[model samples]
Structure formats: structure tokens, C-alpha cells
Target: MSDMYKAPQAELTNGEEHGDFGSVEKGIAGDYSFSISETVSEGWRLSKGKKRTVWLGILLYVIALIAITVVAGFITGVFTAEGDASFTQELIYNLITTIIGFPLAAGMTMIGIKIARGEDTSGTEVLAYFDKIVPLVIVNFLMAIFIFIGLLLLVLPGIYLMVAYLFAIPLVVDQNLGPWQALEASRKAVTKRWFSFLGFLILLLLIGLAGFLAVLIGMIWALPLLFIAIGVAYRKVFGSPHRA
Candidate 1:
């Protein structure tokens, strides 16, 4: 989960190795040589499989969810009380909704990274990750903004943009990069994959549907596992330490 364990690609001038696990098994194309499932599980195994972190992650997440829901509900109630509203009013509300809980989204990114790395990050630690990941956070926000703008044009194009940038979070979390760099790398990473990475997207969308159908209980089990697998992917694509 933590990208600290990769095997070296080439030694650095100071003798430290560049973060890379050579020859992954489940690499997207011929580029990567790694297995997604195995790396994530390895991360979970390292985290000690404790229930405590899951509980905390879930609690923080739910609280964030409730806060946003309450805010949206209040806004909706206000609009209804005032009678019919303009499309512009509704549109403004929607954008407000998107911006409201950026902190929480950022938190999830950190928690997912920690969970994958088998680390014990308190909620405080999540905050710490955010501090360290400010570049990532800002880049991520800007990217989302770009996607939202694209969505304002045509819906399908927006969806395409979303998928293209899906790897931004993990890229930043694992690599500690700026937004542009992360986006650049992610674009390359996604493009160099099996069936254009559409299969991966479809699988995740299905998993999301299943998680929704299960009343989110499935996510408690699923999130950690997914992170682990991605952690493995990180290792495989990027190299060891990140590698399982």
C-alpha cells in the first residue's frame, strides 16, 4: 500500500534506487508486469487487517456525507419554499454542491493510500497527508474543475474526461507530484493499457453498483481491497516499494 517498498530500477547518484519494481505481472499492456489483486491484498495484510481503521474511515466518510446531504436538503427546501426557481439557480446550487466537500474527498484519497500501505493514519494523519499533498490536492481540484467545465459542454465528453483523469488521485498519493505532472503521467498510464483501460473502468463501475445495492456495507470490504490492488498496480507500473 505504501509506495515505500519498491525494488530499484536504477541506482541514484546518492545510491538510493529509483522507485520501480521491474517486470510486473498484471501490467495494463506490455508496459507493466504485475497483478492488481495481489498487491492490494499485500497492502491489507501489512495493515494488520484491523477493524479499527475501517471503522474510523467509514465514520469520517459518513459524517462528510451527512454534512453535504443536510446542506443540499436545506438548499432544496429553501428553493421549494420560495416556489419555482430558475435553471440558473439550480445550476448554481449544483456547483456549490460539488465544491462543498472537497476536504472530505481529499481525506478519502489519503485514507485509501494509507489503507493500501498498511499504515496507521489517524484522522490527524489524513490531514497530514493533505498538507504533504497540497500540490496533488490543488491539481486534483483544478482537474475536477476542468472536467466540470467539459461537462457543461457535452455530457459524454465530460465522462470521457473523468475517466482519463481517474488516476490523478492515486498518482499524486503514491508519487507526491504536482497536478500537471500527475495528469501527464496518468494520461500516459491510462493510454498504455489493456483495451484502452475501458475494461478497468467498467469493472469499477460494476463494483460501484454492487456496493450501492448492498447498502454500502460492501464498501467496507471492497474499498481496502481495491486500494490494495491499485497499490499493486502502482508497484507494477511505477516500480517496487509500490510493488507487492
Candidate 2:
């Protein structure tokens, strides 16, 4: 495995440099302005020749999700006599899926990062972040709780947070931050241009909707485009791993 794929041995300090990649702290504090057109175009450019690998990764990810749901449903079914799981059982099922899902989600983010950085991917990159599974799960769990609470209080805070923590998983995978650290870092960095990020997400959602309308097979293309775009955004927010 390359250094890019490996987790950092030491916790990143504020403004600490990561070799030729530059300081993430600097990137965070620097200009948050980025053109969605350029970002999406760059993503499309990087994704051009890697369609097969990207599609395969998405397919595998979907399969894994279905498998997890099926297994969870089976286990929860054993405890239910009415053919419907109780609230507790449903919650348990969701918890099981969420715990198992985050690492895979991180892997997907890593795959995006890899594409953004022009690194090679084997499609099996979807399975690669199990090493960081603990932090991934914890960060996601905390994010879910916070977002839920925010939603209960007022709708806007939850919406704000939904956009604010976009880079949390990437932070964990790329910068090797702990759970809380990753969440905070993502929130703070994205807070600078929260509306812009929201616009970016809206644009991505539009793209996804367009893809879904195209018989869903277009998602193989759209999903990769979205991830690569997100990867581009991640690199834009943090610093790029490669030297310019």
C-alpha cells in the first residue's frame, strides 16, 4: 500500500504539513471559493478513462448494502412474530447497518480521493478502509446523533449540519483525524462557505436525479461523477496531496 492509502501514524496538529501535500490547516483557512463548473468538469475529466473501475466499485458497494440489509432483516425477523419488526428491532437493524456502513462509506470517499489525486484504483477500493472502521463508525454515529438533535430543535440547523459535515469522512480517511476531530474539522471548514456547499450538493442532486431518470443505468456514470466531484471538492477544501 502507498503512503496515501495508509493512515497517518501521528495525529495531525494545526497547520502541520503532510509532506508535499501542503498544510490542511492552511487550506482550511484559505479561500473557500471554488467554481462548481470547474470542479464538476475536473471530476468528469478524471472519470473519463476510469469508468469500468468506478462502475465496478459502485456495483460492489450496492451489493454489499443489499447483503447487509438482508442479513439484518433475517436476524431481526427471528425476534418478531407479527412479520413486522418493532421500533426497537427496527432501530437495532438500522444501528447494525449504520455501524457496518460507515467504513464502506469511507472507502467510497477514499476511492473518490484516489480519483481526484489521479491515483490508481482496483474497484475493490470499496473494501479498503476497514482499517479505519472504528473512527469511521464513531464519527458517523456522532454525526447522526447531532444531526437528529439539530433536526428536532429546528429544521434549519439540521439542514445546515447536513451540508456542513460533507467532508467529515474524507477528513478521517485522508487526514487520519479521530472521530470528533474529523467532525469538527469538517464543520469548521465547510462553515466558511456553507451556502456554496449547499449549492454544490443541490447541483449534484440534480445530476443524480437526471441519472436516475435515465433508466438508472446512468447512475453507474452519475455516481462516479458525483464521487469524483466530491473528491475534487475535498481536495479543494483540504489541500491536494499532489504538488502542483
Candidate 3:
């Protein structure tokens, strides 16, 4: 089995080698940190020569998304007579998609982590996290509610939570932590360097935007690069488990 599939034994500390690729260097104040440039550069490097696999995985995910949307729409349509859906129908549709999307998103994160660990992947691994659907769904739902409430209070709090909780799902999946525990762990870890993490997210957003503007084909590369970069950041902050 690939090291990616094996359960990690313990969290890696500063200066530990992630795999055969490289080691996580120590940052200021003895806290874990990652360079935005280095992280993205590593993402680009790993993404290189793996376009087909990455694209295939994206295609599968997109198809699954479309399938769910169609199914949900069809189900919603059964309740409405007009072409437009009722508010309740729309709510139902969103609920369905959101519930299903959590695990899929986690799967993508898993694939990114796998790639960051220098393992080969087929992209189809996006379907692998359904086994942990309950916590995955709960954590995401709670995250959305908190972010929504924070945004309602003021834009800054919402944005803060947005960047802070970025690793909640990954922690849940990788460390097998419960929903609230994952949220707290992610929030606390990210709070240490919240601004830096926000900047990293902004840079990634820019990269994703650039890909979208490049005639859309760039997404094939851009999407994988984004996820891989995120995975790299995740490893930097929390460290990886020991591979079997």
C-alpha cells in the first residue's frame, strides 16, 4: 500500500522529513511555518508530469457533482409545478448538495495530501472518504453556520474564521478527530499565524483566478496545484503521521 493510505503513527515535529521529498523546516518562535512561495512551488513541482491523472480526478469529481445536482433538481421538481423552484425546494437542493459535497471535498484534500507526500495518485481517491461521512458533514455544516454568523456580525470575523478553519476537515480525516475537536484544533493551530495563512489563501485564490482566465484549460493544472499547495500547508502546520 502507498504511504498515503497508511495511518500515520504520530505527528511530525519541526525538521522532520515528510517522505523522501523534503523536511519541514523550523520557523521563528519555534512554531511551525511554511513559505508561500515554497509551498506553491512544491505544488507546481509535484503537479508537473501528472496532468492526466489530476485532470481525470477532477473530471470524475465534476461528473459526480453534476449527477447530484441533476438528481436533486429532479427530486425538487417533483414538488413544484413551475420551472422555478420554490424557496423550500431550493433549500432542500442546497442541503442535499452540501451534505454530499463535504466528503467529496475531503477526498480531494486527501488526494492533495497524498501528492504532497510524494505518492502517486489516480484522482479517483476523491471518492475515498465517504466512510467518514458523518463527522465530515457535521464539521462542515457547523463551520458554515459559524462563518455565516460571524459574517453577519462583521465581515472581519467571518473572514477570520474562514481562513482559520481551513484545516478542520483535513484534521478530521487525517487524525480521525471528532467534528468539534477538529474545528478547535484547526482554529487554534491556524490562529498562531492567522494572517500568514490568510495571505497564503489569497495567493492561492489569485492562482485559481488566473487559471480560470486562461481559457479554462488551466484549471486542469490549477485545481491540482491549489489542492496540492493546501496539502503542503496542512503538513507544515500539523505535521504528518508516521508512515508504516
Candidate 1 residue 127 Cα shift, in angstroms, is 5.2
Worst 10 residues of 2 by lDDT: 11-20
lDDT of 3 by residue, 96-210 (tens): 8878888888888878876666554667887888899999989988999999999999688999999989988988888788999888888877787888889899999998999
lDDT of each: 0.54, 0.75, 0.75
RMSD to true structure for each model, in Å: 7.5, 6.3, 5.2
- Clashes per prediction? 21, 0, 1
- Those runs of model 2 whose alpha carbons end farther than 4 Å from true positions after fitting are 1-23, 31-33, 73-90, 240-244
Q: Give the distance in Å from residue 174's predicted Cα in candidate 2 to where it truly belongs.
A: 1.9
Off by over 4 Å in 3: 1-30, 76-87
> Which pairs of residues clash in candidate 3, taking residues 3 or more apart in a chain or in different chains?
9-242
Question: Which is the leading candidate under TM-score?
Answer: 3
| Per-residue C-alpha lDDT of model 1 across residues 158-209, encoded as one tens digit per residue | 7666766766665665565667876766666655653445555565566657
Give stretches of model 1 more than 4 Å off.
Answer: 1-32, 40-51, 68-92, 123-163, 172-176, 194-197, 207-217, 238-244
